[model samples]
Target: MTSPRFVIIGAGLAGAKTAESLRAKGFNGQVTIVGDEEQLPYERPPLSKDYLVGNAARDSLYVHDAEWYSDQRVELRTGIRATRIDRTSRRVELSDGAGLGYDKLLLATGASPRLLPDTAGVHYLRRIEDSDRLKRLFTTAASLIVVGGGWIGLEAAAAARQAGLAATVVEALELPLLPALGRDVATVFADLHRQHGVDLRLGIQVEHVGNDGQGTRVRLADGSVLEADAVVAGIGAVPNTGLAEACGLRVDNGVVVDANLRTSDPDIFAAGDVASVYHPLLGRHLRVEHWASALKQPAAAAASMLDKDEAYDELPYFYTDQYDLGMEFLGTIDGHDRVVFRGDLPGREFIAFWLKNNRVRAGMNVNIWDVTGPIKALIRAGRPVHPDRLADPGIPLDQVATA
Candidate 1:
């Protein structure tokens, strides 16, 4: 039997890992990867943290070097955008006037930063080039005005602090990271920046941004104006689902997919931030921007394509380094009303567990040593931990699940 041709849209983690999973499953079919970026699939998590701090090199951020793709026999079509998806003919049209035929398709187009059009002085930190340009600004600028209190914004603020630049962050929301994190956990970040000398302005919106040769002026809705050498934006992201929507695929919140990660059209599948996959545990479709979700979902989609039945049931985990502190979030946080913490808050370390009905549903750890196995077990076994034992650092967090 001839191996089927597989065309994957997006060369990010989802598209790249799907190809790797295909070869790992012993399917030797034609795999062509289409991406708009010039570089091959590389890790994005570090782009705002270590990469932005100038600690990690560009080559190191790549999951696989040139050798891995060559060995896996994956054809890379970088610097090409999939303009249209002809589900009727099972082909994708590229901007460069090339069309690729496929028996199966995977949409991993991912997400793009929310950037204001033609904004004179503000920049968004989304890709390598975006950070590279920001880094240049970092070297010359004396002060930085960051808009938004999201992860990207907070992370950049941390980087700006590390660079010894006078950094000021303006968040429209009441608290930084209030959308994703509960107030209790968000406070940790709010404190982290303030303690590090970040001029945090919360509950403020940018009314107008005007720039001159000397610096940029950011006028706030609260009748205040702040000037700085440059402005960096850390507003969230919007899923790149336009092509999928144009293809007549259902795109409610994102590219809707069943529990099996199959799109409305069975021949075409979608994953990553662009995919709104049904979560059986959550009892609804969820779009997780976490790295683990992006890495795990595409494997299930590929397995389903190769006639392997696997329900992508792994937990989600994402880690971020803000200055010298390391923070990690695991499991699902929805429907969690109660949270219990492990370790002291003043000792510059702690872990917050999101509990629903006395069982751990999600968690966030700050500076806790070797917490991976414990967080996974807490989610897996539905562990119920005591509040007192959790608050004591001597209690060894990894053993909490067993205790």
Candidate 2:
């Protein structure tokens, strides 16, 4: 019997994990991983937080050691980008004009950062090289003007504060992180930074960036200008879906995939940020950009590729290391109808629960991750809970949970 030939794209956490899962699932076929980045499949979460502070070194970024790849008998190709896919031939064309035929192909190309157009000294961090460049400039910069109050912007701002750089965050919206977290919850985080000496600029629009030779100047709609040693934009990211689009497959904001993470073509599949996957749990096509989602979704995609007796309906969860707090959140937040609080906001030890018709829809705990199991089960079962009991922090979360 002939073995299966598997080809995976974009060797980030998603691509790397899928290859490992293939081997873990007992498939010993020829697995080829093609990636654009020169470095091994590394974790991107640390690049913005610990990596900038000198706590996390480059060596620690690798998701799997070199030996693991060799042991798994996986063909790893780094520093190579896939140009297009020829679905008719079941082949992927590389930048250098070479082609690799595959019985199954997984698209895990993540996302690219959005930068301010035609602006000099404008930087966006998404790769290892971006981290290195930012770190060098951070050492000399005294003040920084950060555009965009999203996760990347705020995280980088936190790192700048640690490096003794005076940082100012400008958000066009009423509050930073508005679309992700509710406005009320965002206030607590805003206060956390303001107390830590960060200048929070909210509800203002940056018209343009005009340079005056010595440093960069950010012009605002209110006729106010902020001069700083450096200007960093942490705006947002667009998924890399061009490859999938060129192949004449279904492409929306991201590559559209079914519940099992399979693309329109049964032979092709997609995971990671580039995939607008149908999530059974949420009952919607969600494109999550979290690191945890990228790592876990790939395995599910691979499982379906191999025709495993399983479904890829995973509970969505993500967290961020902002300031000194470890913010952990679980379940979906969009469909949630009601919200319950377990603790006080000013106290810094609290959990916010999003309830959907009496059931816990989503929950977020600051510096708390131990009780995630019960919250996860409740969301899966769509169980209901009393408002009073859910609001009391004195009652343990696991007590209300059933097997």
Top candidate by lDDT: 2
- Per-residue lDDT over 1-403 for candidate 2, one digit per residue giving the tens place of the 0 to 100 score: 7788999999999999999888889888999999999999999998889998778889899999888899999988999999989999999999877999999999999999886874787878899888888898888889988999998898899999999999999999989987777766777778877987889999998999877768999998899999998888988999999999999989998999998889999999999888898877777898888888888987788798798745567777788887787888887777666777788777777888887778888888887668788777767877668777877878777555433
Provide the overall lDDT of each model, using Cα atoms, as 2-decimal numbers: 0.85, 0.86
TM-score of 2: 0.95
- The 10 consecutive residues of candidate 1 with the worst lDDT sum are 394-403
TM-scores for candidates 1 onward, in order: 0.94, 0.95
CA lDDT, candidate 1, residue 8: 93
Error of 2 at 337 (Å): 4.5
Model 1 TM-score is 0.94
Q: Considering summed lDDT, which 10 consecutive residues are worst modelled in model 2?
A: 394-403
Cα lDDT tens digits, model 1, 44-144, are 88888888878889999786887888899999989999999888888899999999998999999999888754378778887889889988888888899
